[model samples]
Target: MTRSTRGGAPVAPKRVTPRAQWTRGSPGGTAGTPHPTASRRRWRRTVIARRAADHVCETFGADGIQGVCGHPEIEVALAEFARYTGDRKYLEQARLFIERRGHRTLADIEFGRQYFQDETPLRETDVMSGHAVRALYLAAGGVDVAVETGDDELLSALRTQMANTIGRRTYLTGGMGAHHEGESFGLDYELPPDRAYSETCAGVGSVMVNFRLLLATGESRYADAIERTLYNVVAGSPGEEGTSFFYTNTLHQRVPGSTPSPDEQSPRAASSLRAPWFDVSCCPTNVARTFASLGAYVATSSADGLQLHQFVSGEVKAELAAGHVSVAIETRYPDEGTVRVTVAETVADEWELAIRVPGWARSGGLLVVGDSEPETVAPGMARVRRRFAVGDVVELRLDPAPRFTYPDPRVDAVQGSVAVEAGPLVLCVESVDLPDGAGVNELRVDPAVAPRVADGRTVVTGRMARFEPTDWPYDPEAEDVDETAAFEFALTPYHRRANRGPATMRVWMPCA
Candidate 1:
């Protein structure tokens, strides 16, 4: 029997003649420990999953096929299987796939070899290139292989690539990919608001790579990157209601787009607004998986104590050399800066507790330890070691004020414009908030006026100007347009925009 993929590609089941024995540890699947038989159900589906690991390891031999698929995914899947089933051979196979890339073994297409990340070897590549999601995924798999094989050089190269990618290629929302064409990464500092092709999958891929690096390096910077991307891109993909999702996240909406039909899958261009469904359907499932396994990214441990990265309201328990430690986290986050951590249970003393203070807290943050006065802490992990007991509380306060943020001068798209941000959330001006017949293009905001949160909404002081249409947009005789009514309007979170209905929105506000 055959199944049709979202892309209309027909996939037929492959029958393996039982040539290779399924073993655990060093070689194959968990033979001694069957995974509860649920994962073993449905022979055909099981074959489909097993075939991906077995056939690829066998088929991609040096004498047979030396190339990888256009999209680099199987490498990471094989590595995951190795981790789950205790098979080193699967890890080796994944390493082989990474090693074989960059040789241009696959024939080139119009988009060029870089589109599939074949222009440079995994080790040689610095700064992500080609399709944003594919480049990130390939790097993620490369990190996986490097971690398992203890390859420091490979890890170092990937770290450099990630830093450069995040610095130059990423958006204010931590969204990646600049060009609408090829769904690929643009040149350094080429980020454009209206043309952003920030696919939700690419955001997920960024988190995946950063998470691996975070685990390998134990650096809080990687955790910072993960938090930014997760709060913006991943959380932004889904609409207010979980029923709809966006295929590509656009930083600006020039035109008001009608809601996508629930029955049909939408094209990338049709996604000015969130769609109920799409043919490719990558965003929904990708988002679903991310949300399901989100706890994995919440907290991690070092040799001595516990480290809390994300600031969501939850309870956490960790076992260290000292003893078992449990704490409950309570925070509204992004909306409010205050985070309260109460010690639920602790068996020992001097267990180091580290909480991440976001880089965006420019002025500095405050950390309160068990009724002590709030002490200023810089960006990075705010750590403290002390004896703890029941009913003890620790608090972290971040600056969640609405402020104007300027972009790099090299970013020509919004060079003179300023965007509004309230803590970790990027705020935007929606057309729905403007007066009748007013457009976002004619909106001019004054940077001199400080923005403030009023009634839980970010209010910015701005004036509406009139742009008279002309046969030629650019003319030497053009005069300064009239600045109409001066008033204050509320700005919505970038992730929460477009839920009211079809609306035009822009994140970077034009300076008057």
Candidate 2:
């Protein structure tokens, strides 16, 4: 698994490597010219972020007292913007609002409570207050900033609140957030199959807040929750097209033609397509902020070494006490688990590189590659402690095979259905890839048959399935029968679903 940098012979570190050389101008000074358009786009993104922050601050009261405005959603937006942009002004505004307008000493905002709509205060004993804590964590720049600023009071307060929330709310299935309306959390241990909220945005937000806390405290629990959320909840939120977004991500889907009204007060059924952006509009912008600030969440450094949290194709430059060390991480992740890390311009010193071998990957018997024979990093995490090297390269590989996953038995909608996944992407059967209206509720797949990639799509041919008409004979027991029909169907990555056309799509399909 190990590949030598140069012909198996240990090569001496050069003052300038290929990457450094490429970064610098060539002899003619014509190379390494910066792209004006690229630079402008980056600047424009910053501008837009700043403007958004300003708008949020201006629209909401700056003093933090209950304003004429109803809820703290605007403040949440402002605080999140501050987290990414590193704007002190926005942070201060967020702080003032939370400290002043927020509920008394120990209480925070409750989901769907009067405070959320009418600005009425509520008790925050141990509610699954992920949303409010998320806003507070973002406004305060996470746990790291709190520690650095020596605000032990605020840090302890937040940690206590979050710990209580996490300890009380998490389901046996590891799901959090329990209310479908306003996507809020319910009272202690109140998760039910048909009532579980577990909104995709809430999962993303909870993970984000936990990530910041992990970075600050170097705790592993936060990272564990993050992986769970990423693999199960967040990955299921997007449609195949990567455009339409799910407001709620259920483990199951409601039968076709049984769609519920917006105010029906029921958990949404899982589907392959995203609903239109909600009036709350938290998930879309939440996705944008997560992607935009992803770099900050990848790795961390101290006097000792670096910790690689997430694996992707990117380079991280850290400033160590000895000098500057740039680590380039090249990997085909979530697709193929091979990851390579090349160290450059690093002084000879003992350092540690920690890699997260996802829980699923470990169970599948993946291997990590170093200079010697491959090593098995346990699922969840693996760490390598080694001495100095300027050009040392490390590679790790995980299992990357397509598999089908069934919903937790408690989730009613997907009881007999299953989802297809490869690497990190969840796949779905799209109606556009099927034959006209025949693709509607009639989609069914044989569990024993494997789907193959053809014409840039994953397709399956199996026994036919039937969808009851919009208005048909109502018989719950009859709908579960496996009719001896057959049809060929194709699926796409969930993130790329809606891009093709208006078509019914289903992530969970009946398994024969």
Candidate 3:
């Protein structure tokens, strides 16, 4: 029967199709596991890189030049974004905001100027200036279009400014910048043995600037300085866990109760364990970024070949004009001293692998496998030349010995004290291992004798080591005759201390 509907025709109820719901096991749902496709992973990485760049730019750019503390980080983030996204827009924005402030040679940009308004430029150049230089150098490459078009006078000025800074600010210890409170910059050449403000960030920033300089000018000294900083200063900043940090690092150690706070204490004479984080909290992030971008720092290329500066276990892929050449270094370096470099791809051209053998690695020098006999790579530099092939392995071994470092007696902190070091890590004595009531202050070790690992820790024992003090003034020449009492003390790695409790800790103790 034909029934008349709305307009004289019979109409039926329309069936509705449910929206495609994304369920756990439904089609295109991924089923609790992510899609194992390259596109998906690449997209995820792109998003993260973009977000990181945007956060840095937005957070720091809100105040213009006032955001110099985060300037270098932001620049790096932007460069990374531009690299990943293949977008010149991000690079342009970074160049406009970060590099547009002043004409080349930004040496006039004074310390703490980011927070101040009235353009009272500071002539007193410091580590902060080095950081700014690094940021500018990072941006200089990505947005070459802007740099080339923008003020040529400014770029020339900046080059001159950086050259002047490099000449004036360097210390005999190879450390740069100085600050007593923030452990930033000290007066030029005020490199005191008792009070040296070799802030970790300053050291790192120096290396960063020098690295860029190396890229700009194919000089080896910049790479040399970087290697030195990595071994002595930067390596010492991170704790054994590779987490904790020290704002200031010194070669000296002082008595436990003499210093106010750890950061304020001078590291020149003697030093103690590194703290987890500081009030400034810049060192931690600095370390994180450095470690994250470590691959970029390892191998640098020139017209000739590649320069391998630092050695660590990792894989490095360099896209050369010939083809893609991959080098994988595998070893427990600094600790075990062996680094194996394996070539993963074949190349027609002969390439040079310049490895840096740390100055401390004397006597038992570097050893390269696949080549007959252990080659004696110099303490400063090791140049290995060979025609590369797939699966070619180069093995290098440096000296791994526990050395005892003694501070200058003139330094008040460790007048008659010495510290033990394995690789770059300073060893210390925790109060937990010391006898009850007899604190670390009463501890003494004979410099002539070596401390060995006993009961899973370094220990020293000797006669004439008593808890009680002698009568009258403490004479430096007069030797104690009381030789009956002797006690043993155990020591742990400096970075491992403070994890137990608030106990007395000392990196250097009086020599018996």
Candidate 4:
């Protein structure tokens, strides 16, 4: 499906063309316009995005072409444009595009209608399929439309779809899209680590949905997903100082390939190392957009209180029902789970302050507000509701002990494998970190001993086993193994892998 874009040979709205991401620099729910002192470029967002959305509405809107675009981004952008321009027509256009999806109204692809989520209606679909990024963008758009139109039914369906997708179709590192064939989601539990396409744009799309859902439901699970994806997938894609980038983030690298040149455009799907650029440079732009708008994802404000989602060090100010308040957050977050939040300015009336305890910290967490005694908190929102003065403080300490994680039995690809995690970071053993003669594919780890963080490195017990070579590899009796050697190797965070040099790395280690 294609729409006439302000008068051109009708163009399909997808990432193929380098369209301006007007929704960047702000999350959702910005009403009216930017401040009067906002820059010319900032003010231009209202004109440029609104005009593009207006063209879309006039062409494919309800009273116009009764068709939808192949890609889903326009709908979500329209919702934001409606907010920026204070125009309800753009909101209606968004609602129309969302309701028109999943009806097989568009031409099918070689990968099938599910590739674009055209197999079922938006309100009836219960699971996410098709291209991982497209499905996520559609869900985000649906949630935005539902929020604006107060469509509870659509919101409920989207919630179910996201829960289903996160529970089954997602990777340990919070990545989606298992197949490189179409950058689409595989069947449930079909995640193969080495072959994962885990496109960087998909991670960005996941954060988009997660942030909206976080605000809509006030759920900690959404924030937890955001943390995992940001640490592992989004932050992992780019190299030092953002000079190079990985288009696809695979969980396991089976072979040590050649290093990428500083000037070359990488093969998008199979870049062995981070390349300087790519022809389809959507991942870089998506990453840049997310980074520029990070403050919105970090926290949100309400009429009565303020909530901190990600523990990044920052400051927040919001206008409450009683009066205005400002808070400053200081933290060393995932590295050391301690966060100190101070009320810089406050209203005399009572109000609430909330900080999130990530779902992964299932063991222990400590919270202290003002002069109160230390209180224990679990995996949810920890709140402090009381009269506040300047310099009032609230503190949170979370458990970040190194732990071993096992996959669900239904996931055959990694049924007997074990992985290590500390806080939100997934740890993997790289070939470069192994002892002599030990290969990533040839070693087996023992999970009986817990992982320990020493000198900022996660060390685990493992052994290298050598098998005798034979002309006919397969045999009925498999007893040609040589003596094995036991040793320990330091596990590096998955994001830091491939940065040292060309090396093979695997997140899922087979247990001995």
Name the lDDT of candidate 3. Answer: 0.53
lDDT of each model, Cα atoms only? 0.81, 0.55, 0.53, 0.82
lDDT by residue for model 4 over 155-236, one digit each (tens)? 9999899999999999999999999988899999999999999999999999999888877777768889999999999999
The list of candidate 2 runs beyond 4 A from truth reads: 1-180, 183-204, 219-289, 362-369, 435-437, 448-462, 467-482, 485-488
Q: So what's the TM-score on candidate 2?
A: 0.63
Residue 485 in candidate 1 has what lDDT?
69
Residues 276-313, candidate 2: write the lDDT tens digits: 44555566777666667666667776564566667778
Q: Which ten residues in a row have the lowest lDDT in candidate 1?
A: 1-10
Lowest lDDT 10-residue stretch of candidate 2 = 12-21
lDDT (Cα, tens digit) per residue for candidate 1, span 66-163: 77888999888989777755667778888888998999877888888999999989899889989999999999999999988999999999999999
Runs in model 4 lying further than 4 Å from the true structure? 1-35, 39-45
lDDT of 2: 0.55
Q: Model 4 residue 239 lDDT?
A: 89
lDDT of 3 at 172: 30
Off by over 4 Å in 1: 1-30, 35-51, 61-64
